[model samples]
Target: MLELEFTAEDMARTRFAISPLWEVVAGLRVLLGADEQGLHRRWAEPVRARIAAAKLDLTPLAALVPPPSPSVPGFICPPPTTPWPSLEVELTALRRTPRELLRALSPHARPGVDAILADPDRRLGELADLIEAYWEIAMAPYWPRIRTLLESDILYRARRFAEGGTRLLFDDLDPQLGWDDGTLQIAHRYVRGVHTLAGRGLILVPSAFVWPRVFSTTDPADLPVLRYPPRGIGTLWETRPSPASPALAGVLGRSRARLLTELAAPATTTDLARRTGLTPGGTSQHLTALRASGLVTAHRAGRVVLYARTRVAEELLNGAGA
Candidate 1:
């Protein structure tokens, strides 16, 4: 028998999706060199400052984060006990009814993503709030502890990306080398999510909420946990940067030609996929190749991953010899 039990809260969660802000962070990492270790090192101090300014009083929890690890750079050590609610409870709620779970965890507020990003003065604040809000929803039971770590992490990361992208733009990086519309769109989603949660009591205000999922690993104590891939597809790109393999170059060239020809006003992976009839993932592969060749640069405008041809790309595309 199909039972229909409805609650406004339940309805909201079902609609929950990955926040676009996450993708923004990803674009920033790709554009700059802050994959994991680089980000940790760059933002450690800023993170600590933000935490202190917020007066969240994380001194009690400081003892728990593991000492800096080269292998896991900036990774905090496991806590003795789960700080938030039990993982079992959180998981059961999520699995039993994903929608209800999202609603329960999500903030009951709306601050459109565009509204926030549009404001020059408030952009940083908006980005922090958005990142924190999403982390609050996704991290679930680990909220308190993870949030503390994240408050610092997100601020540092967002600043890095925004500032870094600004530099690239001013440097006259060929407009083609900048991120596309899709990435910007994804970023907007994140901005909206953050704004919505801010209006709700869920956001702590001044202190950002950090999403635990940003961390690649899980707490051993939170056993039977779900593990997702970390930011940046390290495996996709080799550890040491070098020229693409001949086979790889041939494949990338064919795709690049197609992508550039289709692009207008800088398109994102999704845009490219829809217009060029290539799968989203396939398009990302081509973009990665172009990125490796210094022929393109990608950024997260909102949610979508935007790819643009670099000056080098233009030269390659325009070379009379070609």
Candidate 2:
């Protein structure tokens, strides 16, 4: 059990963010041991084939992202934030990682650590280069789809936060997590202890890749980061849509019908556009029509507007199915 004691100020300061760099790093975990990350097997197989075909030297990466162990350093997977931080920005942050933090990593990682310490600029550059190459081979192609899933999760959580405040947000994050009396507890197989937030607050990051478990930054000195699997990850690899009912299509037209069915979960106009291969403006137009028809409702979460099927729309879909 990991207990994170929080103060009123800490609660107020907590924020949610999405990290592209962290996703790339977390995705590599699948490559390290595909069997262990069975949830992503469909995605991992092709990426594995590409890595093998390219003959990419993943030695550095393999060393960097080792199996879950208490010895592994938290600095490597720094807390991620919104606006999708660039690789360079994350790399710079990594370069600034305190030397004491590196000691916490696996003993096998000492050589890489020593190399970085010997010549910080050159070694860090090499590390960044490896990360870039790995991303190009494994993640860059599927990032847009991955980004949409992550954004949708954040939007959903934001609504939860607004509706019931922090307790609802944390409680719904994962079964392993709970909040009681200003203390957040996490059930972890390896870690057990009580940590005070000390006014630094926490950063909640929703990840599409880190499934089956929740990960937290090890160093308490750093701003605490909690990376957990987002809801609806089971559908991330589902590319083809369930065929829209002919009658529904006839009433709303094929495009509109398809959009309505896809809103089984809340989604932004951009998310719908990507999933349906429609232009953003075109998707927005269709959503407006659906909203006007009382088939869907839209809620603004931050700068993005999320659309969900109204009760009438759900009944319409169920009736069509029947």
Candidate 3:
């Protein structure tokens, strides 16, 4: 078990961020056979075909994932300075990482990575360009959907914070995580230690590609970050039917019944509002009424509560609106 000791200051400064670069790396892993159950197969198969068609050389980037070691060096994957920095911004930052730091970390990396570390001035730029190419093919096409899911997780986590401070916020973060007193316990096979966070707070980053596992930055020199799978990942690639027929609108009223059909898949209030063409306040009010009637259920996934149709509602839909 790896434990992080949070000082009073660390808790105060802790924040959340979404990293596109991390997704680039994690998505590459899916193509590299890391996605055991094909959880990402729906997305990965096509991405793999695209990489093949483009003949993208991902060797240098792959060196940073699992080959050089289970632990990726922080120089290439530094914590983002903003909540949602662009991929270009992060690549720029990666390109600018001090050569001295690169020199310090270049001991035993594979040939692909060692080349970049050996010549940070020239080779690192090439590697950054390579990452950009990989991102365009592998990540950019699916970014909007990915970003929405990550954003929903952040919004939900903020609510958890208000409801019960950090305790509630960390409660459903991951099965491998635990919180008590002022420490966070992480169960990992290789990363085991007790580190103190003197002042630099932790960065909680939600990822769509890193499902079924979590990663933490244990290096004291770099900013600490906890990267975990966001909620709703299993259904991230699934498509929902276009707004259903208005058959059920009669019993539940046009608005409430529309929401009931929209719950064909779990969705956030904001998402439902936008899709259903209802105002946010109107969506919330309708959802509350539906929940009270046992026609809809609110499920807590990470920081956000996703509303889905209940069995009773499912029956009602098929009988009248199916």
Better of 1 and 2 by TM-score: 2
Q: RMSD to native for every prediction?
A: 21.7, 9.6, 11.1
Candidate 1 Cα errors over 4 Å, as ranges: 1-252, 320-322
| Backbone clashes, each candidate | 28, 0, 1
Quote model 1's TM-score: 0.24
Residue by residue across 74-131, what tens digits does model 1's lDDT show?
A: 1111111222334333323322322222222222211222232245235434334444
How do all the candidates rank in terms of TM-score, highest first? Answer: 3, 2, 1
Better of 2 and 3 by TM-score: 3
What's the true lDDT of residue 169 in model 3?
A: 92
Model 3 reaches what TM-score against the true structure? 0.74
Q: What C-alpha lDDT, on a 0 to 100 scale, does residue 67 get in candidate 1? A: 24
lDDT of 2 by residue, 1-322 (tens): 9999999899988888887678767787767772374888877876777677667777766666666543345666677644467667887787677766666655766765776777766766777787877776566545555766777888998899999988998888999999998999999878789998888888888887778778886465577888899889998776445778999999999999999888765677988999999999999999999999988876543344557677677678878971
Cα displacement (angstroms), candidate 3, residue 193, comes to 1.1
The TM-score values for the models, in the order shown, are 0.24, 0.71, 0.74
Off by over 4 Å in 2: 34-37, 68-72, 81-83, 96-111, 241-322
